[model samples]
Target: MSYLRFDKTLMINLEESLPREILRTNKSGAYHCTTIVDCNTRKYHGLLVIPVPELDDENHVLLSSLDETVIQHGAEFNLGLHKYQGDNYSPKGHKYIREFDCEKIPITTYRVGGVILTKEKIFVHYENRILIKYTLVDAHSATTLRFRPLLAFRSVRQYTHENPHANREYQEVENGIKTCMYPGYPELFMQLNKKNEFHFEPYWYKGIEYTKEQERGYDSNEDLYVPGYFEVNIKKGESIIFSAGISEASTNDMFEKFEEQAARRTPRDSFFNCLKNSAHQFHNKQGGKHYLLAGYPWFKCRARDMFVSLPGLTLAVDEVEEFESVMETAQEAIENYINNRPLNCKIYEIEDPDVLLWAIWAIQQYANATSAEQCKEKYGDLLKDIIEFIHKGKHDNLFLHDNGLLYSNGENKAITWMNATINDRPVTPRTGYIVEVNSLWYNALRFVAGMMHTGDKAESIFADSLDELAKTTAQSFIDVFLNEHGYLLDYVNGQPSDWAVRPNMIFTVAFEYSPLKPEQKKRILDITTRELLTPKGLRSLSPKSIGYNPNYVGPQILRDCAYHQGTAWPWLMGFYMEAYLRIYKTSGVSFIERQLIGFEEEMRKHCISSIPELFDGNPPFKGRGAVSFAMNVALILHVLKQLNKYY
Candidate 1:
């Protein structure tokens, strides 16, 4: 039995299966997602979702789902499940599911009377295609399968109503037919591995309700266009494959290509292997450079996410080439900005000073993982170039203060990672001399200085002024940020320090180059462990803080207000583990290892085989936010490897 297998007892029960969703992504930024029971409960769920760069760099759901029916001896059974208006389920196919498993791919077994059929699904790694193969496991006589293609042909974020503009005609392709619903979208090719007859009976399936979207207070109901159905006959032990994609060429060697791609996949024998596989999903080629998608389903590439997640997502996994490529991409973006050229890369709408610092820190991590000399040989000049940009202040409002802290002022924008704003107002509003920014600043300066210090007088000349600045920053950081309260302040403006007990202080100790002393690191961890640390991750704010929101719920405005207030972000767990280990040494290894086990257990709960973006701060710390969050998975793998280094 596969690790993520579910029997008919659970599959037949919609309550248990509806909430559990499955995801399959390709290297080309296409994905297949839906609930475990082959039903789409969310608008983000789709059978063929691909990126359309010309359509504003967002994923478009060309084909929502493909419903199948089994016909035998003049009897027909629909194996498709859809929720219509009035909370009714049509063609409740999930009731016939004998078994379901998601070890590597999603496989569902169905037994209807004397006929038993097994269906398996896989998405092509480097192409925009989905292949579903059905085999006649057992049968008394000849049986037939009918496939009805449901096309949404709209942005995943939007819904489609019954429109006259949709083309009702389809052109014959190699093994099947291709049809284009919208003029701007690509033509969707619905082909088969074997030649079959195409019956064009176009109709609209209206009032298809998306419960998740409704719960989020958005337009939940949509109308889907079913162009036609494909019918084919099969005997016992015979299998048939169905393909769908933007191009007819994607169907070439469908089965053989899927097998070859599946063979190259990393084994999901353990939690770590699953995470390693998930790390690969975030990488996509865009703008002529390798980029990492922040998360699955929703998030696109962002500068902060790229830099913060680079070390864990690449270097920790021994993906040296990927690490270098990402760094080069970041450097190219900075150069584009320096030369006043079109950015054309992943640049956050609000430029983050800490993101620039994290780039330096990520390179330092790569140098630690590999050899410093090797890092210098490849990224030496690139690091200098980035440092030069930071010093030159290419980013808006970012400047090095006389006190050695990086300062920026913005009333309505979030400058740091606590960068969630609602209705034109910054939530956290960490505008000036944020705690984490300064911490990263000191670390970056010292780290790059250490890298440059490896050479002679001429080569090491850059380290002289940087070293002095880092020294000044460390002293000023302790004076301005540290206090008798036993924890570092979250941020400091012209007035008194905002001494909210936040997890941002942990980075000051967790980093390889720390500004705080040994005792200070211990004190910071003490407060962090007592207040912010949860079983799943680190809380954004302590419960003792004034504006702590334990539960992240309600409308967009409510959720945005609580985004960084007290949301327990799984990515922060990495820094917490690092800080705990740095202070307690080997004695803390088991503690972190045990905590990692909790995260592994979480993979079984939400977004099976992946980590979530955030959880609630209070008890029953339920996983909320994005389902397949990339940074959370990357950080967990990176920090676990870091802990293992001690042993």
Candidate 2:
């Protein structure tokens, strides 16, 4: 039995199948996402979602969905299902689905009377094209299939309505018709591999309800334009390919292109294999430069998330060349930050100082994987420049204090990853010498100093000076943040330490260079395990705290209030596992493996073969936030590799 397949029982259950989603992406910033049953439940769901440089830098839904109908013996069987308003389902085609398998490409088998048809889909790598192959498995008579293209040429963030600005015109190109509903957007080309006739009938499909958006308390209804349909006739044992993309050239060699891209993909036979493939999806190219995307369906490549997710997504997977390229891009971004240049921050924003600190940790991982000499040879100047800049206090209010600790006045802003806001106000307002920032500061200094001291080309490149600075910072961290409850304090200023129980304390014990003692590490781990540990991930805040919000529900304001208050974050599991192994040594393998079983099951639950961004901190931790969260996927692969080292 395939772990990623749904049987007839589950496929026919609309309530169950329609909620589970699947996502496919090409590294060129194009994605295909929708329900398991081919029903779009969210506004973000689309068949050909690609970035239009002419518009904003975000993705626009060019081709929303394709409705296919199989006609046999004067009977029309609509194989396209959609949920309308008032819980009404149009065509209700899921009832005919016999099986759904996501092990490879998304393949759905349908049985209409004695006819058996299979639909397989894959998004081309490094291209904005989606190829869908439909095969007539077994049929006694000839069948005709009609496909209607649903076009929503608008930004994914907004809903499109019936408007006069929509151009109901098209041009024929290579046995297909190209059309653009809005001006300045790329024209969408819809074509078939073989010869087919395009029916020129334009109409509006209105009142399509995005249930997921409505549940999140947003406008959910939208209107899509159906330009026309493609008609193709097929016999038994024959197959046809449907191509949708921005460039008409992609329509050529449709079958061969599909086969070529399929061969290039990493194997997806197991949980780790699936995660490995998903990790590659995060490495995207924007404007001729390679960068790691933070998450899919929404997020861009920001500095903090890119650095935080870099090592796991690249180096941990043994992708050295790509890792080097991503590091180069990050180094350039750092240079842009250091010079105080007004970058196109909309593309790759740099706000958090922790991201710069995380670069040291990522470099340390690279050094451990390859060699310290290799790191210095590749990024010696970049590493030295970052350290020098930090020492001189050139960025983000991060300056070395008189007490030998790195201090950032986090006042009136949420600088770190706990940056969730409601009505322009921070939720977890950590506005002092935060615990995690100082921990990262000490670790960054020590890692750089250790590398510089032992590096082959090292001739005392401020080696002793950085070591002394790291020592002072580590001592000050222990003296200031070590709370009476055994775990490190959340933050501190001149007054008493804010002893809030948060998962940020895990980093103090997780990093290679830690300030805590062996007993202190154990106490921190035990406290986190009792209060913050959940099946999905470590909670951002402990439930025992009065500030904890159990439910990550309701509208944007309510959701942001709970986003970091007590919501469980799957990416934090990487640090939690690292801390576990650091304190318990190899004896902790069994405990770590037990906690990972939930995530393995989670791969098949919410987003097939991937992890979501956040889950509810309370019981039955349902996956929330963005569906195919990149950092969560990267950290899962990272932890699995770490576990493999011990087992």
> lDDT of each structure?
0.84, 0.85
Worst lDDT 10-window in candidate 1: 345-354
lDDT agreement of model 2 with the native: 0.85
Q: In candidate 2, residue 22 scores what lDDT?
A: 91
Give the Cα error of residue 261 in candidate 1, in Å.
Answer: 2.0
The residue ranges of model 2 lying beyond 4 angstroms of the native Cα positions read: 250-252, 342-347, 455-461
* Candidate 1: tens digits of C-alpha lDDT, residues 1-647: 56678899988999888878888888767899888887898888999999887787789999999999899889999999999888899989998899987777778999998889999988888788888989999999879899999999899889988998988988999889999987878888888887778888989999999887876667889999999899888889988889898888545587787678667767665788778877888887765777888887988888878777888888878888889887787877766765678877765542566776777777788889889999888778777777777787776767878888888885677777887888777888887778888888888888778888997786588988789989999999998889898899888888876778999999998988888889889988999999999998999999999999968787778888888999899889898898888888899988988998888886566687888789999889988888888779888988878876888
- Error (Å) of candidate 1 at residue 6 is 1.8
**Candidate 1 ranges beyond 4 A from true positions:** 250-252
